[model samples]
Target: MQTTQIAPSNLGVTHPLDMLTPQEISAARQLLVEAGLVGATTRFPRLLPVEPTRELLAGYVDGDDDYDRSVLVTLLDTATGEAAEAVVSVTRGEVADYRVLPNGEHPYGQPQYLFEEYERAQQIAKADPRWQAAMRRRGITDTTHTYLSPLAPGFFPYEGETGRRMIRSLTFHRNFEGDNAWAHPVEGLICHIDLTAGTVTRVEDDYAETEPVPVPLQTRHYTPEHVGPARTSLKPLEITQPEGPSFKVEGTHVEWENWKLRVGFNAQDGLVLNQVSFRDGDEDRLVLHRASVPEMVVPYGDISNTRFWISYFDAGEYLLGKNANSLKLGCDCLGVIKYFDAFVADDDGRPVKIPNAVCMHEEDYGILWKHTEFGEAPQVRRSRRLVLSYFATIGNYDYGFFWYFYLDGSIQMEAKATGIVYTGATFPGQPNRHAPEIAPGVIAPVHQHIFCARLDVAIDGDANSVQEQNVRGIPMGPDNPHGNAFTWNRTPLTRELEAVRDANPETGRSWFVINPNRKNYVGEPTGYQLIPMPGPRLMAQEGSSAWKRAQFATHHFWATRYDPAERFPAGDYPNQHAGGGIGEWVQANRSLENEDIVLWHSFGPTHIPRTEDWPVMPVDYSGFWFKPHGFLDENPAMDLPDWSSYQGVPGTDVDDAGCCRH
Candidate 1:
């Protein structure tokens, strides 16, 4: 390849050395001499007078002494008329071979053979079309190129002594960390500035690789396209409150709000059963007189009216026959309704009884004479009281509820619990290494860890909660309809084609190919569908925007539950089948290592960081709250000492080694 030269005026016009003071010029000259540029015989005209005889004798004796000297070329800012540091490079041409030294000093020991090889590579690179394209894309249009040339000891060069020169390429470009700095390894034979015209010269290369290098890039914005029709519309419900009656059963208080009876079975139970109704205002609605159950176990089996019974004492009649003594006579028969009130009137403007036919069990007397019939039974009970308490409360800001049941037969009671919904974060992964194609000069990487959230619940009671149950959706293997499979080289969908298209747009196109062994979490089917969107385009349409769109749906539901051990172990439910104890909450009280939870939260869907979310985050409280839940005994007497009331006695300290004494 032929070498292009930028004249002296172009070299020093924006060069720094031209603006240096007289003393600085002297120092720079001395530096150049030390750097093997000027010869020892070259006298400083201002410092000493040169003898013509001596100069002539020296020149004749060592005519080629300065043939291999170095030179310093300064670079200056075009806007400022001040001295800037001079950049130096070396170019050596011998016979048919040529070499160019880089602008900066080589930290590695210079190898002559390697330097020659670099020069040859530069020649090839300058003629490479691919390299030119790369440089153009990098926005490097102008090159104020410089090189080192040998200088003679005399005032002027003699005939045919125009010295050998070497071209070294150098330019100012941004560094790896985005800071402006001089780029290194200026061996490439790029075209430089034309001195007189102050314009960059161009070079053409035909012998380059035909294939372009592959570069991966991510879009700053993504627009999602719908793949299928809308699944369902969300419906809103009104909040319902509890009501009816006032009673104290166990440690819970029950009251009537509207037509419904509100009851509290226990403080820990919050409030149970939002609404309870009664047929008559005077009759009691299932009250529990006593209850005592063992810890960690739910009571089962029928408990009707054995030792427990509701009586109509006001009507002077036994509403439910009392059986405080029978073991085999279980309360299982309590479900049988003996009589129902009838609104009827008779003769003389006075109310009279028009009883309905009663039904009763009969034993067969003989096979031939066996018969059954409806007969009238006397009206014994008028009204009765049913016993049970129900109420609920919001705890730790999470929607949770506790239930207590006092049966009509056994002395044991049962408690049931449940919790709201939540999702957990994924495990950390490796860093991304892909680089952008269009902007190779600008570097960015793919980041992992997205779409994650958490909830915390608190339990304030005697028993601890255990994770006895777990429910996961489909395994979401590489073939699953979710986009996660398509992203990681996963194969085609295993589900129905319509469902797949509706759920995952990344794989909606039949032409899209992926690997067959990628895995992901295929959560339960949410009422959503993915859709196809436009691919990235190199140019914007006329009167159109220039943003690329994404290709998938981004919505789903997550939840958790808590219940009795027997009812737990249920399949496909959030935290279902998990055994329960007293006052348990879900997703609360994270481990000690999470002390920074309130300080730093992981980034969400948006990868960009803003200045507002800093230092510590806002409050994130969750779980159930208990009202009138016995934190302590109701009215216990105590002259409690107030620790906060104490004040320090000024100048009253005793010996430092001893305990505090008056």
Candidate 2:
């Protein structure tokens, strides 16, 4: 859904699930300021719409217009390194709740980095005498064009740095203006700066006495002008919908075919689908209450001092939606499109609108069903799907999240990973176990892009139960006469601990969220199966920092009783926290029987870079599928229009390639 569109108004919010508009953000900031909560150094690290309670939304109808709107703003006092969270009701023009964040005690963590901190960190690094001396040792004196990347420093028990607002920087030299900074890496020099104190706390130079590893100086340009001549062999392919699209949009509520959902965006989670329902016959059956990819961790595999503590929680630490890309037509998407504008808070707690932040459109998906009988005309139907997608850039990597709703009562979420791979400097043909040399003198460390998706299951209604299904081959006995028999077993995940399961590809494992109260035509519980594209879970050893902090990625699936406060997979703030989130929530071991349950499925690719992944890496895809199991009585797409009506021109000769030649 990547296309350009005019930014919408930020004044009218008719629904409780509507995203915070520019006016609402300003009002919330004003309320905080009036309450003496916002000081000169107070910055908005995060702001999101407080999700309305279900009871409040139960009676909601379109055009109700007078609903309550609230914003939850996370405030950080940069001068004192203090943090607090406040909830302000924009409708009532009052502060609802406020509490100081426990960010200075044990399991400490700082708020997300401000956009202005990037420039500040660069200046701090360039001005430091120690950093400048290290640069001089490498024969580089011009620091005007140098780029000091502000990176999240993973938690460590160091004396001066523990429980402090900090940012670690890596220098990248640019030859001149418009030059790609990633091409030249200043290896073996790391700068640690205390953001609150505005001073460099520590400087690590691996080459203070020894010879330094030469930086990768080759111009690894990816842009068109730098790459010289462009390829002209390909022809332009155009897609158009002359009569316009079939989907209808009113505010954020979208309706396409039988699908109905509200598009939601915020600072943390990029795209959230709320109240997803599918029309079955005359009833709009509830499929999911909400769904979103809330958090993901990129844990590098290298053990060098430069990158050993290098696990990054992109959503929690950097905020995916806040850094989302403004999509362009013909480049990011095609066909008839609709774009949704997103408004987020900046450093000063002001409204910042990201125009055309979300993309929505339809795609032609090959054949849905096809058959050619021996003595009958061929029957075929072309498949079409509605796509809602967005892209976000975090540091060097770019990620695209695409959600598809198909006509056959199926849903799919895919994450496309592409961009420049994070690199380090190494001699050509150097042997490195954890980091692979993708290009000459450039090493790309092995890493995993583990994404956790939260699916609030509502098969027929809210009272649903999750059951693990495994298909196993039966032994060659009375049950299996021919030794090729197989049987499947469904084990109810009765508790949170029981639901902490992993994928078993050998047994064809899957999980089903079933409504125990609703029975299908065959007397089976109406259910939707979660099919995982199983891959290796977290590769970090047990008890390691990465394993402890990102426990959500350790298991392929987890089901817990629905709780509004239990939103993020890795707790509220995972920037430098010790460990929380799912690992702590399941301590209660809540029951999962006939109750509203949310499914957390973690899956992604464990990347091992190769030569082909050099300057820019192609898209590496990973995701899961949700489809109707026994929820539908029959094939949902059986009534699809057949494509066998088209007849070839009379007396026309057709070639074997399905082309007509006269």
Candidate 3:
């Protein structure tokens, strides 16, 4: 709990877009305490750095000290369920703005749960008489090892709990301290606990009248100690950079190859890229102003009373960066790595540092381009990419968010989903349509992991427009004499309503952000295309609870005129609110022609559990690409070193690693 002492004199080491340092976090908290905003029950649920305005940044040099630095802290009173947002200026050392959050009104939504609330919910559930009676009926007398999972209670108009801050608890029996709790789910029991009152309002006990479903006795342990075995076939493959990595990091700014960007992290979004640009010739053209996956919804497809109301907004409800994993060397990252430390506020409003929170390294991508004449040696150049990534563990699932920059002026965002699946107990070999049996008695309900990425695009500059391009096939006519001719059509998305579209894989659909003021060598607008990995959108029926809460998932693409307040695709407090995010934003139907705009892309997998997903699931990947369609005149990687130059002579001991040498 030792604090890092920071002063205003050291602010030069940070950019306006950098994540708040431990010193800045503590300074903001001190300003709040001085303003009489801190109470005994007041807790810091979320704290994020407020980015400077575009005008301010346009005038900023690399080490300018006049730019503003601020922090936005979300405060919750755990005793009364009250919430408020405060903006503090660390540079000016004062409170700039403060407002109370209306959390007790209709369509109420509570702030995120504190770390202490998880233990509080467990204590309340175990102390309930009805839950205890149900456990005794199941003949589980030893309650010391019982684990009560604190789950979010999606918004429902149930009596006595309509406007109250609540968390629903599900019981799981653990045999011992290190036992896996998810493997032994106690079916047909739900405990509703009110956080403000510190009591269990109601308990649904299916075993009270009928026979109880037995908890699965299988100990699904995945650690090496429990499953005693070692594979010897694999040989050691060491990835050592005898020279250093190709990327340079000065504070939060990164420069690798022709790509330059600023790194940021917060309690909600784990990693953020700002002021991203690719060097073309002597100029650095802007591509994106800011980019991050701000929110995601994981909704289970089940009709059972045990899990009917289950849709978790991972970033909005439980902060993603708050639960981020401190990455390891060989396990999570390889090669010579550059680590960035992240600082977030704890419940007591103190700075907690997550060391090695962001990992940066270079990866060899096989080949860039190659071609050879009939008689000449093959001319080939190796491809490489700069990767920046971070991982977050939420409940039973762990997610890794990665951002990759290639030498060809392309950017890609990938999300890796891996961990134990959420399971429920049932009869052995039971045939359930909604829930598939992943194990003998364990059934994992079908679910979807939908992630929404916020891209504040700056194609050439801020004045950009969007166009949807789809491939069209020509019928047999003069235009297609051989019946093998097809062309593509680009439609202008001039309004917000027209911009909310879905992916059409059959047409090879993609969206382009183009700057009308700037033109490439071909006389077309300089543009960047957004190519989607098309998949099923949200399967929930329209007007359903899950559908209403996660409207962003219903479409694969959304474009809106840029606004700083519209950072989160889902509304700020999506914990228990009625639907109100991108669903409501597009209703404005504002003009998007030649304006500064933001794009929200929703994409992920709709998972149907399989037998191979048992124990611990391997990494499932889903992502999209933002490539330079016409942003550059030609291939920017033509200057890459030729690998054909490194020829192994007959009697000479030549290492293939020499190909990397210029």
Q: All models: lDDT?
A: 0.20, 0.88, 0.88
lDDT comparison, 2 vs 3, better candidate:
3
Q: Across residues 1-662, which tens digit of lDDT does each residue of candidate 1 receive?
A: 43423322332211111111223233334453455533422221111001112133224332222221112222211222111223222111111211232211211111011112223334433444644564455444432231111101111112321121111222223223322121111112233222112232333221123322121121111112312454468663221112211233221123322122222111111122322322122533221111111111111111111100111010001000010111122221112112111111111111222221111011111121112345853222111123231111111011111122211111111122221111001112322123111122222111111111111111111111111111224457656667443233323222111111211333332111111122113431111011122222112122211101000111111112212221111111111011111112222323221111110001112111111211111222111111111111221112222323546343332212222222
Assess candidate 2 and give its TM-score to the true structure.
Answer: 0.95
By TM-score, the candidates rank as 3, 2, 1
Residue pairs clashing, model 3? none
- Order of the predicted models by lDDT, top scorer first: 3, 2, 1
Per-residue alpha-carbon lDDT of candidate 3 for residues 1-662, written as tens digits (9 for 90 to 100) = 32223334475345677787888888889899999999898999888888789998898786566556889999998878889999988887778899999888866888887888999999999999899999888888898989999999998878888768899999999989999998999989999999889999999987678888888989988899987897889986656565567888888889999999999899898899999999999999999999999999999899999898999999999999999887743357666677788989998889998878888888888988999889998878899999999999999999999999999999999999999999999988879999999988899999999999999999989999999999999999899999999999999999999999999999999999999999999999999999999778988889998899899999999999998889888898998887789999999998888999999999998899898998999899999999999899999999998756756342322122221121
Model 2 misplaced stretches (Cα beyond 4 Å): 1-11, 644-662
Scored against the true structure, residue 82 in model 2 reaches a CA lDDT of 90
TM-score against native, each model: 0.13, 0.95, 0.96
Looking at candidate 2, the ten consecutive residues that score lowest on lDDT are 1-10
The TM-score measured for candidate 3 stands at 0.96
Which residue ranges in model 3 land beyond 4 Å of their true spot? 1-8, 11-13, 644-662
The Cα RMSD in angstroms, rounded to one decimal, for candidate 2 relative to the true structure is 5.8
